[model samples]
Target: MVTSSILVLFLLGLTAAAVLAAASKVLHVKEDPRIAKVEGCFPGANCGGCGYPGCSAAAAAIVKGDAAPEICVAGGAEIAENIAAIMGTEVSFKEPKVAQNICTGGSRANLLFDYEGVEDCRAEALLYGGEKSCGIGCIGMGTCVKVCSFDAIRLNADGLPIVDMNACRSCGKCAEVCPTGAIRVSGMTMDLLHLNKVDDCLAPCMQKCPAQIDVRTYIQQMKQGDMRGALLTMKERNPLPLAVGRLCPAPCETICRRNIADEGVAIHTLHRFVADWEMNSGSRVRLDCNPPSGHRVAVIGGGPAGLSCAYFLRRIGHEPVIFEKRESLGGMMKGIIPEYRLPEKVVEWEIQTILDLGVDVRNGVEFGRDVTLESLEKEGFEAVFMATGAWKVPGLGIENDDAEGVVDAVTFLDEVGESIDALSGKRIVVVGDTNTAMDVARSAARLGADVSALISCIQRKMSANKNEVKRAAELGSDLKFLTEPVRVIAEDGVVKGVEYRELQYDDPKKATGTPKPVEGTETVLDADMVVIATNRLVDVDALKDQNGEPLFEMDKKTGGIKADKTTLQTSIPHVFAGGEAHTGRNIIIQAVADGRRAARAIHHYVTEGEIPEPKNPQLRVIPESILKNMQVVYNIPRIRVPEISVEERRSTFKEEVKGFVEYDEARKEGSRCLRCGLTCYDAEAGAEYAADPDVSRFDESGKE
Candidate 1:
């Protein structure tokens, strides 16, 4: 009986082994060879940071050429490059993204009551919203820190998670585990709605602004009807919103990513609207100044740059005394900008608002004449900032150019803008093709002069903004393109006309074409007073040292101050320079940016004894899941806010562009923004489902 049973068991075992062998051959699946090669290069954390199911799934996708190697968000630039290396292709990466903790209110969070409980976030989260006044904040439990496979997160002294970017695999685990949703990705796409601060994000619009203004935030605030909040965000970086709104040639609009499909957002006009709302709504930018630092700084030039420096410095608890040679505090805006374009009331209100922030403005105190750099230092001013603008004309060495009627455009505009009686019946010929020339011509026309502009460059080469040109044309100002003025024609100091020659471009396509004067084409153009609208020279005497040399080293080529481009620091260790005095873009927004930067550098130098390395704007990548149908949010066409009619513009300079944007209009216009920043995630929901996600839904987001 035992022998028979053993033989039967052995035969059954052999039959079973044969059946299993057949099943193995039938059930096997073949994977591509490249999948293994691709998997070999992965970071191997299997965090699903690349929006994949796992390392194996991500590897398979790469081999099938379904996604770029940069799909991994946690590994940043390195992982992207390595995956690209496996495919034998050059690395193409997207913006760098890292998880960031949003709430700094860890220790500051107020508690309803204190009670002992489990140390896990999920446990605390269920007990009366995690014991904090801010209901939607980090719960301070280490559930996320405990489960981190790469050990990238830790609690700071304040009980908030500190993300170590270098080690994080962006597996979305920590965000998934956080109970109160305090931690989030910084640059989530527009569709990825955030729990708080849904508007503020690092985007190309913010990066492109020289002011680095949080544009999307303010726009979002505007959409939500938070006018005060919108204005507050603008004031964080730029002190003057009303002035910039009316006068800035917003380069921010040019780089808007939405311009790829259609017209760019009217960002400057939106600024005007927001500022006007703040002004009309009786709201002031509210901020607490730092406690007095007991340091006095001297600032020269009271324009946007100087005022901006003073404003920021004062905000940080330092005292800044601004010196202006003019009787009033307006810089370029007051000095030259016409009342029609920038109302006198606007400049006065903007500058006065800054001055109200505990700044000292000493009018008629010249930099070099009344107050020397050495004297300022001797007077207990620890640092000096020079923003004396390019206010005078450099010698052009042209024949008969020294006549009394020959004026630099800046000074001419200043005088004409203040009192038009002298230029009221004068036949004015402004020389040059740059925006400066157009400004001179327009201001002269507003003053009742018959204005004409002489340009050495051809029609297409005119440097004035097209809007300015159109307005000037409508105002009956004549534009003489490709006509070069060779000399001022005058019998005495009083100007009568200008001698000119036609110019021919050697290459029409060249950006800076070689212009040759057409010989025998010289002719005398009639005029009453000739204004040379050229790049104004910095007033060297205005910034002279006691020895009569320039206070700062001068750039021989541009004849501007030699200051470090990034730091704005001059050769003198204690001095810094910016605005038109330094060689840089002279637009109003750019000057504002310089002022803010210099103020930051000066604050650090005074407080920390060293200038901090300039930090690039922190960026975050847009997930492909959100990008695939981004059009749903970004598909709205850009709205062109109606402007004051050409008839009204020509009739009076009473603020040419329309300032009003109704609530409905603002919503439509602002909606066109691409909001190129990251959105927050429902990581708690994500992680709960992470372990055993519904397969069909899991395949859609690729979130393991």
Candidate 2:
């Protein structure tokens, strides 16, 4: 038994020895001996922070002189020095950088829209660009939070990601995961500056100007020669193209980008050319109304808003009955604008076109007097739109305002339109510094009146468009800046001059309120007639409820209507109000937009019994190339279309500003539009590469 046990033990030991020898010989890895020495000096973190696969690989490269010794960023300066000492190589050092959040704006502090959808930030970004006020701001959708493997980050109450520096190893994973360029690594000394990314491209001149002039559109259009289309486009927005083309303040030119390039485009002259073509060639615009909706609307006042409302209402199959206070249509347009700028015949032609659209005209009918709100209801009208413009002249509150020859600008313009003989040779003093004041000054100067304008604002601070002011100057009118009308001077109830004081702007950047009077700068100017061109006032008593509160009551403080800003509806569900009546005095384009919005609201109210919410109120983005290629031009001198010669202008109230471009010019302006509707595609080829798991991962061979 003893002999058998010994033989078994010897055989077991021999088998174990043979197995160990075979394993070592077959699975041998021949590594350099210096690699062991180099790796011993490392921190042994195995963090894979160095560019190589691992610390072992990094050690091998350093031993072979293939890689620099100071490659491990996580070990930093101390580890780098140790590796360099073992490698027998010297290396320069750099301070490590840390990731930072540059924007101070967070969800709790910055205004943000509620976005409910997919959990992924990429999916949310596809919808309206992630709901931030600024286009380029952080979405704070927690993308960085999810990508952090070390659990080193937490989203604050404000939805902003806060990084815990202690847990952070500078892995750079959060920066790669952020969809927006919100996360960035920088030196400790770096100071971040916030950037504004709101799109201000479609503001002021581009959107607010009447005639939908697409001042940019026509500049590019006229540069190309699609004159007929350009003319048609102009007529689409303004029915009285010839009149607006001739006398609009050209607000677009005042804010023209080309003004920085030396001069502004001649937008008004191009408009005049197209308008004259359509009018002279007997190419009248025809209307196509839908089948009757069995709804009838009553529009009070025949001014721009009223006419525009009537035109649109008729197009949508509703019958519009316009009630004008005067014997003719075109309320303010007919009563206030001089014939030298807008001829009665042009107004007649435009009104005739609206009438052709089946609009019922009830001339010589005044609202609140000849007609009442109850009367319209009794007449079977489904809706009533009150556009009675602020025709009442505002009081200056100065003494002797009731004296003779102290006329309101509206009344003076009305007399000029009527060709009254009283304004032939009188010396006129026009007050205020708006487009209306400029119009009055130019009209009075052309009428042989020695005109002088008294503006409370400085010459450089005039609110009127620069072109209009220049035109007034060219007409030989005297302009007195920083002048305030204290009182009207008179002798025996007859006007003699204006008692005034010079004023100055205290704050140029925030100079919106009343002016500050200069001490001991009181002055008086000699005048035979005084025309007060102050702002107009609106009376909303007619728009009241049974409780005597405004029926369409808006917030008295903010001046914003109580209804939704997008829908433009009033407090009353069935009624909506817009234009100057709701928004005080605004530009023609804003008034037109208000009318259009109100019409849409009324249509929705009548059909759906509720106001429709806007699908998306954000501006659509087109490709940069599309915007760059869009051809916009300005040809006229940014001045009102030239009127009859200075001599002829003073003689009779003839339409001024003759000479328009040919069909070729109009066509060219039409072709310059980039259309602003094309979609942009992603430009990066590697954008889709990150989505593929196989392509994103590194293989055993270290090749991806």
TM-score of each: 0.68, 0.61
Task: Write model 2 residue lDDT over 1-704, tens digit each, in one string.
Answer: 99999999999999999998999899888987779988887767665545577788888988888888776645666777877887677866343456655333454222457788876666677775777654444577788778765676777875667777766656566776666656665432121111112232232234436433445444444455555656545544555566666656676655443343224455666777766666777766554466667787788778777787777677666777998888988866675776655677777877787788788999998777677667887988877766666665677789999899888888877786455454566788999887778889988877678888988886667777676787688778888887888999999999999988888667856766678888888788888989888676566565555567765666564343344566666665655556666665555555555555566666666656776565533323222312221122222222233345655655555665565445444443333222221111111212223353422332334233
Q: What is the lDDT of residue 99 in candidate 2?
A: 61
**Against the unseen true structure, what C-alpha lDDT does each candidate score?**
0.73, 0.63
Which candidate tops lDDT?
Answer: 1
- Give the top-scoring candidate (TM-score): 1
Clash pairs, candidate 1, are 176-683, 187-677, 187-678, 188-678, 188-679, 189-679, 303-331, 340-653
Q: Ten residues in a row with the worst lDDT in model 2?
A: 189-198
* Model 2 error, position 536 (Å): 1.2
